[model samples]
Target: MRKIPKPTLIAKDVFLECISTVGNLLLKQNYEKCQDLVEAAAQDFDNKFPLLEIYQIPRNLTVLGSIGKEEMKSVYTYRMVKDGMPGNTFYNTLKNSAPYGKCPLCSVRFVETLDHYLPKSLYPILSVVPVNLIPSCSSCNTGKKISFPTNSIEQTFHPYYDDIQDESWIKATLLPYDPFGFNYFVECPDSWEQIKKDRANNHFSSFKLNTLFTAHANEEFRGAKDHMKTLFNLHPDELIKHLDGAFRSRRDQLGINSWQAVMYYCLLKDNWFVQGGVLTF
Candidate 1:
């Protein structure tokens, strides 16, 4: 996953801005009463985030008198998401936080919306909290759904907190097939703790990223298939140099672990693929 710089928006400011637009007097009054609770939840998030202690945060805080979970969620869906609303600016900011508008969750798809890291349906108090929101594509967001963590290890990578961009853990292998198939996986270093490796593996597995990457990787190969065959016929050594350049370009433009980067790495590493195997496609 790509590392995203966290949004600078403050929770109290966003919470107040969102609640200010409520025309309903009763709802506004109830929301006014929960300012401290919302701020506390944000603080709890800030304190626990680095420690993977999200599962310990208070939940279903029935403290928003006359304001149930659904109402609190509307503060985001109705107020913040609507154009020209007070909270809309912050909403857009969070959604655009991903570098180059790519979803940090998968680093594959373009970011389409903001996802609640701690889903607002379950943790209403964090509905507007900047740290709790993540920029993600629709696919990644749908893959996540409203699933919440029950333990530290269950928590997926938080792009802002967990920077895996420089950490090249994704590995792709070119398998024998009519044309070919890619097998993608996460391989952490031996120095990492078992829990950390398991968490990474869980994140990779739960998202079905291997399948996602495989599809994209194959499509990429399809486009390059003819060029590779032509290059090998021109000169096999030239094909090696060309594949090396492709690997370098992808590694430089995208991060090392990107599907394209790993795909090129696999192609360059396998001499048979570069010299003759690619002709199958």
Candidate 2:
């Protein structure tokens, strides 16, 4: 999944107004009103908040349950009011929907439907927390990552918080026509052996990253795949030169258009293409 940069509160007036309207509805237990405010917010960015239907009832119900509690009460309430219908879920989806925040696996540009690193299905309570939201393609969201969990790191990288720049995520090798070619498995360093292994296996199998045929095959990555195929037919040295030039061309043409794509390409440049591997500049 490509990591998108943090968003500025650019739509300050709309954001604030919607937040205030929704917050009051929640306070007054006017759920229908809250939903309408959310619809408006979603409309501001196009009709992007479709998945919001799932979170609405659960969010409202959770808010009702936590109002009187002490510790996490405010946290949840603030999340509810602050996020409301469109607040957290809609905004997050909006950011993800941009061409910038795409899933490397399926290569679809998306908004809020990204699968949580730890599936929100598993941790529904934290669904609205910014830290829990991840922007990924719908195929990556639906085809794979169906309620999977990562025990190694209790939490996955937050697109807004974690510096994913340190990780070699795309370092994974693409296997044969496994239909789920996006499956990325790796041998972990001894220090992070079991955890990394578990993470890899879970990522590989659950996310269907290994599937040779994917929705992305027919859509976004068709050209990249054809290019790779041509390069693959060449000798190692030729392939390296070809790939290097190709990657360079991609960068030149798409110079960091979106935060997510930029981060993904940067990771590939650092970890794979320029790490003294087959590809060289």
Candidate 3:
């Protein structure tokens, strides 16, 4: 997962407004109530976010409860896509959440979709909750996490709230010379293990991050066959230097504004700084 740029409260409100309008259009049973429901959802989503202004609405009543099929069937896409505002904004927002638009599940760069953390199939009403929606690569979206809740909130990483830009987000163990070449198994810390196991397994297996690509990169970085070889053989200073350089090198290589690039860099920085590396600036 990448480090997503937090959208301004106003921008989020804008998105909410659009969603409400669509909702109102679909559920036209009561015009006045539909207006109120839109207002309430905006307030609710805003109140949850600190450092953001709570947008005021005309009245406090909530009338509309769900998105009507009419709205869903309506075609809406953004500038980059053929459809127009709602579709485009949704796509761009999810794209921003991904690591260079790569799937978090498979790490593959392919056409992705907006995934509902709480599966929309089960809870269709939550389909538009901005916080509930995530950009996922095709394989993970279609093949793995469809409608499944692997763990509790405490055990899993919430893309909106959890900061994944640290080594602690995942613990990697290099495997011994293995036959399958399935090099490493990533686990959360022992303290977090029992509770997080299911979530971790889901994350690793679904995204395939524990596979060949990540392992190869890990080996290339340590100049070893696996993480243990790098850890046991390398000096602390040597580790610091390499990790530091790698982090710095990525900032320019991945393109600064890209959220995934920023996250990968932050993880590198945190890894070395924890080991006594000084911050120059």
- Residue by residue across 120-212, what tens digits does model 2's lDDT show? 343333333333345566666666643533233322233443332333433333323434233233334455545444544455456554343
lDDT winner, 2 or 3 = 3
Candidate 3 residue lDDT tens string, 159-262? 55544444343433322233212233444556664545565655556555555345554445344324423532465566455545655665455443223333
lDDT computed for candidate 2: 0.40
Best by lDDT: 1
With a 3 Å backbone cut-off (N, CA, C), the pairs that clash in candidate 1 are none
- What TM-score should be assigned to candidate 2? 0.45
Q: Please give each candidate's TM-score.
A: 0.95, 0.45, 0.52
Give the TM-score ranking, best first.
Answer: 1, 3, 2
The alpha-carbon lDDT assigned to residue 74 of candidate 2 equals 35
Alpha-carbon error at 238 in model 2, in Å? Answer: 5.2
Pairs clashing within candidate 3: 77-83, 77-84, 78-84, 78-88, 105-207, 106-207
The segments of candidate 2 whose C-alpha lies over 4 angstroms from its true place after superposition are 5-99, 104-109, 112-127, 146-150, 153-158, 161-184, 187-194, 212-240, 247-281
Clashes (backbone N, CA, C under 3 Å), per candidate, total 0, 21, 6
Best by TM-score: 1
Off by over 4 Å in 3: 9-82, 97-99, 104-111, 150-155, 169-180, 190-198, 211-281
